[model samples]
Target chain A: MVMHYPNGQPYRTKQLSLKKSPYPTATLYGNRGMTLEEEINESNQYYLKQGIAVIHKKPIPIQIVNVDYPKRSAAVIKEAYFKQPSTTDYNGVYKGHYLDFEAKETKNLTAFPLANFHAHQIEHMKACQKQGGICFTILRFTSLKEVFLMPASLLFQYWDNQQANNGRKSIPYEIIKKQCAHITYQLQPKIPYLTYVDKLLEQIL
Target chain B: MVMHYPNGQPYRTKQLSLKKSPYPTATLYGNRGMTLEEEINESNQYYLKQGIAVIHKKPIPIQIVNVDYPKRSAAVIKEAYFKQPSTTDYNGVYKGHYLDFEAKETKNLTAFPLANFHAHQIEHMKACQKQGGICFTILRFTSLKEVFLMPASLLFQYWDNQQANNGRKSIPYEIIKKQCAHITYQLQPKIPYLTYVDKLLEQIL
Candidate 1:
């Protein structure tokens, strides 16, 4: 059995990032040993340092039950539990637009399972959309090594259909390929999704 | 021994929110026994529910060092520590603009101390401001029960002055009153800050 983080990254992958890469500057796909979250984090760092954007992954929510304070050391949390996030994983300002997104990679090559998303996340995105925020998903088909930036508006259609029991449990890859902007991974940014965000802004605004 | 959360919220004040108020709907100033965080959360809830804005307080960041997974039970975080946040407390979208802010309450009557802010938070806000996001601080004078929304641009002037070792360590109450927009406590939203955000939008844009 494989454990997974609340954000949907595999628990085993956490250690992979710690392992020093033989080729740290590898631009080749699948050679970097980087998870989607790590790649995005690197990209965010690049964007921030380059003065391109200011995006951040919201820290995982934890319910601290007990804490211990030593004589002179930093306080230690003795007991706590992960709390389900009420919103998406990532959000920040980008070129005057409110950018919000969740990144998920699926092993399934044919369809992206809707189980990766929670109802609250969809609802949160809808509320954000109503407020004119640029909401979307950074979805990756891991086996295929393909990624796409799917607009929240397009996501809502599938979500509503699923909720109404009017569609399949997963979105077919074909539809995703049609409706979403395919993002190619790059060395500098890892994932140049913001270029698509610029396209999204033009269409929506 | 006073305990403070990483966000600067008092530990004792945490229990105050759980107490059943005799006058739940009391509009009297400081009679509700609510902290500035609680009030801002209430206002964000109101805004989110009313489709007014999609603001939310980022959860306090924690670094999980160990976890215990018992049989058929939720994974318990056995070891963790509070991490200094890299960004402001509250951030989200309002009418297409990215809104970022930190909320701090001062007991001092004469001035709001600059010590409440972290350097990284100021740096983050400056970056957001560069992206054309509406960044500010929601300052509360707890003793006087006054709230003010000071724009980040104005804050930079004072922050830079202090950093240069050429100015006072605190912004005087009179200066805050003059430079910031005063916000009044209200029943529904608790803190009617967005009304001033609209005005801010007009001025900035």
Candidate 2:
């Protein structure tokens, strides 16, 4: 049966579910409209092709409970469940520096919520940061058509504050605009995120 | 239905298939009959606990299809297929340096076969190497009870030579014994692989 929104527009469950997909799908046209992960993946591919960087979105972890093997055919997974990943969704090497990050999207114009990140993911990023890997988050305000690369250190401050008794649940949009590295979209590479990563590298070195 | 091997021992299809499973399974014993991936995972856990290094096995890439979303219950994947990975199996950061590697085990005592590696994996490693990321392969001779970390540069040489006509199909056991850094199994970490990675770091530095 087809579903509809309360406003009378048709609801697309498949597209909604696929938008949460962990892997990138192919796009035939220029960036007409894509999710944050898709944009980063395309930019990563461009960087890889140009020999500027080597990065990839890690595959979603699935726990397989049962599989079927038939004669003269490939094995088919009959039962499985999505397993939670211990690390962030994206990681790779760039110019001899280890880069790690998580991408997030939100429609709210006032702020980006901290609940979008998991506690374990925060711990993982903290561990990577201790190892000197450049860690950050790619934040996209889709309604505002803006993106920012916020360093992990700044994020930890907010996270720790929220864990305390009285802390704000979200980061103000004005704060992100002032503190983070804003990435302008481009034609060839789409996101041009590494330009900001290079900036982070300069600060570190 | 039960089957038997040539030596009259009952065949364990599940264990045989599980041996080829990509993700590591838990073990209660102290390095008692674990696969190469399991040992590496255990050692990675130890390293993570000790703040020595941060490494993880990339989850197996799965192409999920036809999920059933029952009300008030977790979604169950009804059908899916395994997708070939474009890069190596294991990668992470160790002391500010990027590490990438593929782990393989063989029963042949003479050599490790080149067929075990995919063409795109070699290309991925080359891309990583050009970016100055540390790349290598973890090879375990199951029958010989030996493990070695062979540099990706060496593996690439063999790979390219084999691509040309009249090249040997495997790296000779003697060459690997002489060229690669051998890892000793330990009780605490199970397989102390990163000690050799530190050695490789010494050479690179």
Candidate 3:
């Protein structure tokens, strides 16, 4: 979902856009622009265009309360609210594999916070994984400009331990760097995440 | 994406609802109450609850133009427009099968019109099919209240032949009745189309 601005930057987090803000707050991804979602989406476009993969980011579900339909015109949504999605943000077929994952960006440098995810997303991913789908999470360290694709199973262990009252609220960045595969940012594809998926395929075969 | 109205009807195609219409015209599925999208969504819910399958309709993508943010409250979308979806609506893991399909309804008794589909959707199903995804289209005759799941390959043949002047613009009702497996609607699942998929899997094995 690339919303191109005059600045030539992809608008992924357009809600926080200063151009649309009458009540301005601190920015999220607007400072440098080109969010992880934007990059990954671009990469997905490249993957699809080249017949490499067919991944897509699931759109956020919304409840429409009011609509205005003009005669001989496209309908306009007047009132709506975002609803909590039951599944992860991204999913599609990748080389005969059903690939599913969620991408999250955290400003925290020390660790990736678990609070970024919802319980349903975890459950959905787990279900997909159980049914032979390849599941993972793309974690983007915005401040660090580092991205990693972490296995869903590892994230689940940390999530399950949360109920014990002794579990860490976040996974250490060091652990992520050690465990997950680093994706090299490419010029054309932007975020070359599928190379890591190729490695997963190798492991599976 | 169940948009439940007080009528106990699932709110599929609710965004295009014409209640606020200054110019009142004929309605789509909203008139009769539950849409084919609704029945399929209801069936999907049943499937998820029973651990039979984990299918979900993809959210309709929207481009938000203006939002109002009151202090200390969730933001409200004031203006937005629906974006044309790039792929099929429903997809998920079904008995380890990567299932992907689109659902449509036409009141025309004699035939199901080919104009109901778009070029991009055909390309998407083809790509998914090439990758061994179980691709199909759920066709519902609203007047008859009958449903059939037609394989993408069969649909593709009709779609490709449409370029030729001699090709038919719509598939005859009799052809669908003879070629596709009929879905017997039941109380629990409402639209139990997956039973036909089970038969397809048997053919595969």
TM-scores of the candidates in the order shown: 0.86, 0.86, 0.86
TM-score of chain B of each: 0.84, 0.84, 0.83
DockQ of each: 0.37, 0.37, 0.38
Off by over 4 Å in 2: A1-34, B1-34
User: Considering every candidate listed, which one attains the maximal DockQ?
Assistant: 3
Q: Write the per-residue lDDT of candidate 3 for residues B35-89, one digit (tens) a residue.
A: 6877889999999888788899998777776666566555577777766778998
Q: Give candidate 3's error at residue B46 in angstroms.
A: 1.4
Give lDDT tens digits, candidate 3, residues A1-205.
3453432223445355534544322223223323677788889999889988888888767777777655867667887766667898889987777889988888889999887778898889888877788889888887998999898877998888885676998989999999889877889798888889888767765
| True-structure RMSD, every candidate | 8.4, 7.6, 5.1
- TM-score (0 to 1) for chain A, all models? 0.84, 0.84, 0.83
Q: Across residues B66-180, which tens digit of lDDT does each residue of candidate 2 receive? A: 5665555555777776667788888999999999998888778999988778889999999999998999998988889999999998899999999986599999999999999
Q: Candidate 1 chain B, which ten residues in sequence have the lowest lDDT sum?
A: B24-33
